[model samples]
Target: MADERLIAALDVSTRAEAEKLVTQLGERVGYYKVGMELFYALGGDIVTWLKGERKKVFLDLKLHDIPNTVGNGICSLLRLRPDILNVHTAGGLRMMKAAAEALHSAAAEADIPCPKLIGVTVLTSMDAEDWAGLGHTEPVADSVLRRAKLAQEAGLDGVVASPAETAEIRRACGEDFLIVTPGIRPAGVSHDDQRRVMTPAGAIRSGASQIVVGRAIYAAEDPRAAAEAVLKEMEAV
Candidate 1:
């Protein structure tokens, strides 16, 4: 089976580093997530490079700003034509809607397929206490649910959430909504900074459309073998 849903989080900081990992992982991974660290380091050309090599890109900058700025940011990023892009849901309905609309118009004008615009509900690194510290009385999952609802209403393709909340998000957003899960620790692996986590197979069973694996693969002794193991695990499901 073609496992297009497995996204490799290229969290490295240099073009050489990202290139080496992509070469090592080869065909086992189809999608690559370029987040702030690498994007800031290499700029958008890295996206162009990845596409040249025929790999899909997920530009996870999590853009959050005033409506107009975020809209322009989305329009600018659309030129790279990432397969997926994201914004912070905390920016609220106006910002999220602006991003979606911006992508729509830009892609239409450019004559390219618009990227799937997803909303970031809650970072897996933060738990309930973390949200409480931010002044929210509700638990983390509750807030994620509320945000997922708002994301759908804002015309977002879906949300980036932890595996623990994938089921609830799916229930709230319905089957077609995309659920991209990060903070995945293959059973018994250390959770690191992420507080909410699930195994690869567990996340798939929970209705996650895709899952992001960072250290689990990047920090492994053999990144190719590590990626293959993750794909095998997903295949078992």
Candidate 2:
């Protein structure tokens, strides 16, 4: 199995909270995800700070826009040179392809390794009913599969999906297509805003290449211990 201990989302509102979590679990986690919350507060400097501390970063802005606009946005983010980045697959093939091409061009220009670009299929917070309301006639799993395939066809590195759909996505997209799941709730942790969640071991067993956990680690009384427990669970799987 690939190292499943990937980006641990620091879903805080300030640099201090993010940095504290980084200090606690930085060594255990492979990458730290600076999502909209923290990124909005601290900007690209957060990524620069994490890099300065020798930690890989995943800038999860989930950029979505027209092809040209999204491409420009991706180029802006590529300048930061994060280890990973993502865009909503719903943006269509042209947007995704443009983003991918821009990322490669930016990396080549900067003489840096291109960041792995993943696609967000569906927010884990949404369910079958939510999709149905949005006019999706198929089941949630089917929709997720469709989006994953679209992302793969668009030349994305992989997708960010719920753990429940990871296995199916793996089978459909092939073994090497990265699966980064976020709706992970350890055995006793609260689910919070995530609706489709699984345990770390279960996610790994389902063939998820990487897991992005937030509250299960960040909200724990001992964040480092929580992160270590997750690593142990991943290793066990």
Candidate 3:
């Protein structure tokens, strides 16, 4: 059974380029992830435009800051009415809880649905070497699991992790928790800077609730065709 869990990463640098991809892919994908590059260029206007086109938006700012600052930032993002938002789990429990509570109060006051708040456990670009450099003695998976448990306790909806860690997160947090995996490269695709990656089918089967694909689709000769092909691969599982 297939789910509409594919989040198209709008990795372009400008709003026009991003919108062009959105128009090209159209409804072939249901969700779009507005990451730092595009967000920095166009700010909330890009999010507003995507919502106007009736697309679900995942605002992947990966916010990491002091609790008060993070809470205020969440307020500003909530007004955009994105379908999903996330913070860095490395920001710790206080920051994550503050984000969640800010989402709650903002949504209630504005009378809108609260976007699913997720924590980014660790970037897929890193591995055990990176963790060691951060002065941690544990393996990458252990660090991810520990941060995931903290996020859950902090009241986050779920976590953003590599496909390799999704099963562990699911085991620790249960089925209801969302696991959004990035670093997905379809078969025969270049891995780019991603050190840890999986095929879309592999990630989904590994207990990921959602998968994010950027270069695999956006950089293709025909983005729409690439997106459709990815959807097909996701459905095959």
Instruction: Output the better candidate (1/2) by TM-score.
Output: 1
Write model 2 residue lDDT over 47-88, tens digit each, in one string. 998888877888899999998898889889887878889999
Model 2: lDDT to the true structure? 0.88
- For each candidate in turn, give its C-alpha RMSD to the true structure in angstroms: 0.9, 1.7, 1.4
Candidate order (lDDT)? 1, 3, 2
- The residue-by-residue lDDT of candidate 1 on 144-219, one tens digit each, is 9999999999999999999999998888789999999999988767999999999999999999999999999998
TM-score of the candidate numbered 2? 0.96
Stretches > 4 Å off in candidate 3: 1-3
Name the regions of candidate 2 deviating beyond 4 angstroms.
Answer: 1-4
Better of 1 and 3 by TM-score: 1
Which candidate number maximizes TM-score? 1
lDDT of each: 0.93, 0.88, 0.92
The total number of steric clashes, by the backbone 3 Å criterion, in model 1 comes to 0
